[model samples]
Target: MANYHRNNVENVVLGRHHHHSHRSKSASVAGHTFRLWNAASFRRIIFDAVSCGASSRYAARSNISDEKQHLQQKQQHHKTTSMKNNAKSEKLSDLLSIAEAETDVETKKKEEKLEDLKRLVKELQQHEEDSTKNKKSEAAAKVRLLAKEELEVRGTLAMLGAIPPLVAMLDETEQNDVNSLVSSLYALLNLGIGNDANKAAIVKVGSVEKMLKLIESPDGLDSSVSEAIVANFLGLSALDSNKPIIGSSASIYFLVRTLQSLDDESSPQAKQDALRALYNLSIFPGNVAFILETDLVVFLVNSIGDMEVTERTLATLSNIVSTREGRKAISAVPDSIPILVDVLNWTDSPECQEKASYILMVMAHKSYGDKQAMIEAGIASSLLELSLLGSTLAQKRASRILEILRVDKGKQVSGSYGLGAAVSAPICGSLSGKPDGGGGRECFEEDEEMMSEEKKAVKQLVQQSLQNNMRKIVKRANLPHDIVPSDHFKSLTLSSTSKSLPF
Candidate 1:
């Protein structure tokens, strides 16, 4: 019985030992899992904070720059589109799809519409060509007419392969049947107006050269037909790309010849169109040399007395004086200075006045003889007033010329007042005698007509002052009122009488 009791006690102790060790192992595993989870969560929070600070500024700058560039590109594209197209009358129901309220949607529609129109024009051209090739001139003509309408409606779309056949039609038409030729040329003209792309395409297909030949040729072409062609040519020169090509083709010389050749009584409008085209072509520096090569300057100089031609001529001469060669060419003309002075004298349009002033200003700036010629032609007083009275652009240009004129006169009046008396002289007639230097304008006298309203008013005031001062002189000298001859002396003085005595 003692041995059995000892064995049961030993078994109970071993069972208790095994239960405590298993519980301890489970507690250690739970503690290790909690530590690992805490570490991972802490690492994630710190990583997020660092990323927010470090990457956000650079990323934001990059994003903003990208967005700004995109907006600029979008705006430029929009402007180009607007310049080339007229907005179609979108249907009321279609407003939701095309309205600017939904910018992205509307923009996509415009792009798609432009693309569709281009494709349509291209197809029309192809059909026209195929029909014409098949000897189906009637169908070809109809297709061309439709293409012309579409091109007019969609301006730049004329560029998409439509100009080629239209130009070819001009050549293919019977020389004697100018009526049919007129239709084709008119179609091309409508297709080209304000459509810069069409101009590039036209130049590419040698239409300019063809038109040059057509105009130069004696087809006994109708005046209206010639006018349409010239007007269209004028429109095409509105494109910068066409200017260099047109200039190189001797368009300037021939165009001037055409003007001179046209009967003055017939096609007056055609003459104006030719002048305008010449003016537009003059905008290019390359064309300046070509224009100077012809007698166009002489034509322009002679036309200056006519108010209608003066404005256009002045605009052309303005561009011409921008270069050394042009200055020489203009000054080289015998009547150039007088013509410019005439424009300033009689023209009532402020725009024309501004152009004339600028041309004179450029000439005066270019050479000594040119400056002297301007003064001799009596332009200084007009320009001085123009500086104060003209448009903002005109004001700046005239002011600059006046400033130079003052300096030129200052040198001439070395002994008049102070060293720079001419600079301070308020009027062209401030000094009584002729300028020692010739580059300045003629000094005003007591009796000649005033060219400007301001000068006219001032002259009236001067006349009143001279009469009053003469009456005072007669009273002070105790002479008879009738013997004073105040009526004869009303507009004169010792200096003024001498000025008027020549009359």
Candidate 2:
């Protein structure tokens, strides 16, 4: 029984050992599982941290890049703006510099002009103090200088009392003094260019008489002296107050003479100057009589077609034709009406055409003989053409002239046919041209055959009369007999009459 109890105890101990060993193995497994779980959680946490850090760093880098780009854009904009400002500043500086340079040049020119004027004044004063030959030469030089001066400078010299001395120098009387006189005359003329006061002063100082004396000297006048005189007259007579003074003197004679003497050597400018002076003088009605005394109407009429002087010459005639004496003078010229009528054909020169029309209108209105002359000059064709193709004013004048001719004819016809009872032709036939006067017996003849014979005789007579009238018109127009085509003329039945003509 003791052995059995010990075995039992051993078995119990083995069982307890087995139980303890199993419990230790279970503990070891649980501890190992816990450690593995902790390690897995740590690895996951570390991975999440690394991901967050990487994302934050990338965001920082992007922000830095954006700031840098913005900075670059600002710098570029600032650089462009600075360049534009610099360009504008440079341009402004250049413009300012140019303006300053131009201003300096103008200032220098003004100072130089002032100094030149002072020198001229000093020279003029010295010239006034002496009359020696050297002084006379200096006087000539001074006058020559004054001639080239502007109107203001000439006026200034004139106001300094230069004119009377210049006129006094005209009496130098030496044969060599002609040049000085001519110079003085031109200087005087230049002074009177735009200064009326100087013009009056020059005339008041006997410059005109002095110039005339030089011109009318026993020695024949030089062409140069005559030219100077012409320029003086042109300048002096521009003033209305001086017109009669110049015209009443021998100046009109000289002007007309100058115009008449247009030689190869004569400058066209001189001729124009003479015409302009005459035109100025002709403005005064009193001067026209003096102009007529020079017998200029014929010359003016002959010169009407010269294009260079046509306008002024016609203007003079226009002024002249305002008076009865002028109209008679113009009408006395053989070719005046014809020449004036021809001007209407100058389509290119409307001014000349207008002036010529004016002269014709005046002459026609004043004189009946002028009307016949215009008709004789074949003005009818020209008038018809002008009425159709001329300027507005020309058409009006042409129409007016045609009306005058037509109205005058109507008056003459009415006066001749009114109650005077010179003769009346029957409707069928007339006895006016017959040698035997047909009494009331012929009026009663009503046979158709006899009436037809009478009609044929009357038609022959009418055709003869028409030919005679046409010949007269053609002869008066100075046209060729065949001017109208023969067939065209034959086409005109007796139905057409002189009354149907443009004239």
Candidate 3:
């Protein structure tokens, strides 16, 4: 029993010692593990703190750099704006300076002109007061200067009493005063141009009568002096108020004489001026009686072929044809209608065509004989061609004439037959089989042959007209007459038909 109890106690003591030792070992191992884990966490925290510090430094540096760059941009922008402003300022200054300089120049020119005019007036007055040759020559020089000046300067001089002296100078009869006369005459002419008040003032001052006196003077004037007088007439006649005043005072005769003198050694310019003056005078219908008193209508009709003065001549005739007497005068000419129709083929001068057509239209509308004359002159084909390929105005006129002819045709047919014949008329030829004298068949055959012949004749007329017109057009274009192929011309002729003709 004692041994067993002793064994139990030993066993219990051994178990207690073993359990305590295990407990102590486990506690030591746990403490070492905790220390290792704490060390790892601390290292991680240190690394993260270093990373945050570096990020803050980088952010600060970036902000500073951005601020500096922004400052540079602001400075550059301000500099660029200042430069643009300065450039604009310089440009504006230059423009302003240039404008001021121009204004000053204009003012200076005006002052100079005023001074020159005053000097001219003084010189003219001196010449008027003193009849010495030197004074006259100086006065003549001033008049010549006045001729070259514009309307404004001439107006100023006239207001300063410069024209009466010039007029007085016109009465000089001495041969030595010829130059002074020419100077005064031309100065007066220049003063009248483009200034109606000056024109009226001049005519009021007896310029026309003075010129007529010079023209009719016993000692016949030289050609140059005559031209100067005609030029004066032209300048005066431009005014409608002066047309009658000048046209009634033997000016028309002088103008016609001047135009006639063109065939001689007279200046062509004088003829042109006379034509223009006559045209102006002719525009007044009452003046047509005076113009018809002269052979101007014949002269104008004959001169229509003159290419140099064709437009003016036609323009004058256009005015002449407006009056009843004028129309009779034109139609009285043997070939006036023919000549006007020929002008329709003048493709080279559309102006000539328009004026000629206008004259014809006026005549044809007023006089039935004129329409027949135009039709007999072969105006239909020419009108057709014109309508197809003419200027806008020419085309309109051509179409109008065609309409007139078309409308007049019915009137002509109706007039030839009695207007009161309402019943149907039988055919003139016998329809019965009974044979009578050969007159009926022969007349019917003759009528048919006449129609066929007329158709062929009209075709030939159109072809001939086309050829002549084409040749004229070629000549005017400065090309060879045969530049257009004959075959093409034939095709054109073939395409044209008298059946379609309104006339």
TM-scores for candidates 1 onward, in order: 0.55, 0.63, 0.64
Tens-digit lDDT track for model 3 on 315-345?
9998888889999999999899889999998
Full ranking by TM-score: 3, 2, 1
Lowest lDDT 10-mer window, candidate 3? 413-422
- State the C-alpha lDDT per candidate: 0.63, 0.73, 0.75
Could you tell which candidate, 2 or 3, scores higher by TM-score?
3
* Candidate 2 accuracy as lDDT: 0.73
Error of 1 at 199 (Å): 1.7
Best by TM-score: 3
Clashes of each: 2, 0, 0
- Count backbone clashes in candidate 1: 2
lDDT of 2 by residue, 297-397 (tens): 89999987788888888999999999999999999888888899999888889888888988998888888788777866767567666766688888888
lDDT of 1: 0.63
lDDT of 1 at 147: 49
Task: Kindly list the per-residue Cα lDDT of model 1 for residues 182-211, writing each as its tens digit.
Answer: 666766676665567766777788887777
lDDT computed for candidate 3? 0.75
TM-score between candidate 1 and the true structure: 0.55
Estimate candidate 1's RMSD in Å.
21.8
Mark the regions of model 1 whose C-alpha exceeds 4 Å error after superposition. Answer: 1-160, 218-220, 262-266, 408-503
